[model samples]
Target: MAATLTRPKLDVKSLDPYTFLAVIGKRVIHPGGRRSTEELFSLAALQAGQKALDVGCGVATTAIQMARRFRVAVTAVDISPLMLERARSNVRRAGLERDIEVEQGDILGLRFPDGRFDRVIAEAVTMFVDRQRAARELVRVCRPGGMVLATEFFWRQPPTDEAREIFLGQVCPGMQLDQLDGWVRIYQDAGLSAIEVRSGPFEMMTPRGFLQDEGLVNAFACMVRGLSHAAYVRKMAWLMPRISRAVPYLGYILVRGVKPAAR
Candidate 1:
């Protein structure tokens, strides 16, 4: 649940996607969450029979959770075919193949018609896309007055000196960090209105381990397996300092916005 202070320069282009997903497995990020499934369901607030579209839905865990929890029809889309396949497998394993549909598609250009979805949600996926374009696509497909629930990595205050150096010096050569204001701009620029922003501390959801625990290392390793060995090592080193700093309250900006009823 904690925000990653600095990520290694892992390119993720070297490994097979399926193998990569297998490495990370179901323990990606926080598993099960600190709160019970009931509490997590409460946070989603999904209504029965509502049509849900998860943009960049990774491996379909959230989509399956939404269907099982709220009795909704969930359509999960990812640009990568391999990811879609993995998500499909998860849906079947959850016995939600009928409830959740896994599709291969791009976030910037959704294949669905306008007003096709009652809700559009994404988790930790928006950061990788063109925020403005992705926002427009999400809003465009959602029915008027429907909601868009998304979580993005954002900084409240700019990173401290040490954090900045780690990102620029050791992590990706020119990776830019997003602050709260920057995120708001993305939503605004994409024409979304009535946005609400919420922030919380990223504590260990389970009784035991925190995000900085070995869990993140394994998750990160799988995530960057596509990169060359040299890139992976360099990025891992940069993360050492931030993990040591161990900033608490590292979490995403939980944002909700609405599409105007009329065009």
Candidate 2:
């Protein structure tokens, strides 16, 4: 196995919310955390010897799980160099390097050929970019009759102006969220059939959720790392209050659909 990449030093002040969380050892970064991931897995019905693509694969957590638990081969991709490095490391640590390939990839323009994968998945990804274009790419790469799945943040109810500003304006600028129906429409417009959706309140950062997603040991490790440096501590201090402001109105939408088989 390749020597584990040295942990890269990051500028805590400038890092995005997800990257910052990853830097501090948070394993589950999506809006609905592990709960939505379980939903995605149940929808996938993965089988051995199948090929899967995990776009925006943060630290390869889900990729590792899919490979180990379902015995599928996973090509995991992310746009961030930092995330990719972490993903590679995690894959190696999980002893899944043979089963999971980590690489840099963009959601709007996936590098794979059309109808290349048995399943295509993106978690908490499309909302940050061109949602329609990303959805089209996901559908394009998936084999005819294959499943395409994604998780995205949505407004469970209209947010107060302050809540909206705190999340969309300050914490995650440029993230485009919509209602659950809008999400279903994006996949439908991309030509997916038999679309299905599961949704829940945003809970990744709630005390119970943090523990649930990271597990007790990992959650404690994350806390230790978060306070290991003054910069990390400061970043956590600045971020938690802002996130709390928006969590009340936010939820996650897990959407899955099948690409129609060739006529």
Specify the highest-lDDT model's number: 2
With a 3 Å backbone cut-off (N, CA, C), the pairs that clash in candidate 1 are 8-235, 12-226, 12-227, 13-226, 14-226, 15-226, 34-205, 201-249
Runs off by more than 4 Å, candidate 1: 1-22, 27-44, 168-176, 203-250
Q: Per-residue CA lDDT of candidate 2, range 1-263, in tens? A: 12222233566799999999999888899998999999999999999999999999998899999999999999999999999999999999999989999999999998899999999999999999999999999999999999999999999999999999999999999999999899999999999999999999999999999999999999999998887777888888999999999999999999999999999
For residues 124-167, write the lDDT of model 1, one tens digit per residue: 56666677788788888989877776666555556677755654
Best by TM-score: 2
Task: Please state the error at residue 53 of candidate 2 in Å.
Answer: 0.2
Pairs with backbone N, CA or C atoms under 3 Å apart (clashes), candidate 2: none
- Per-candidate TM vs. native? 0.71, 0.96
Alpha-carbon RMSD, each predicted model? 7.5, 3.6
Q: Which portions of model 2 miss their true places by more than 4 Å?
A: 1-8
Quote model 2's TM-score.
0.96
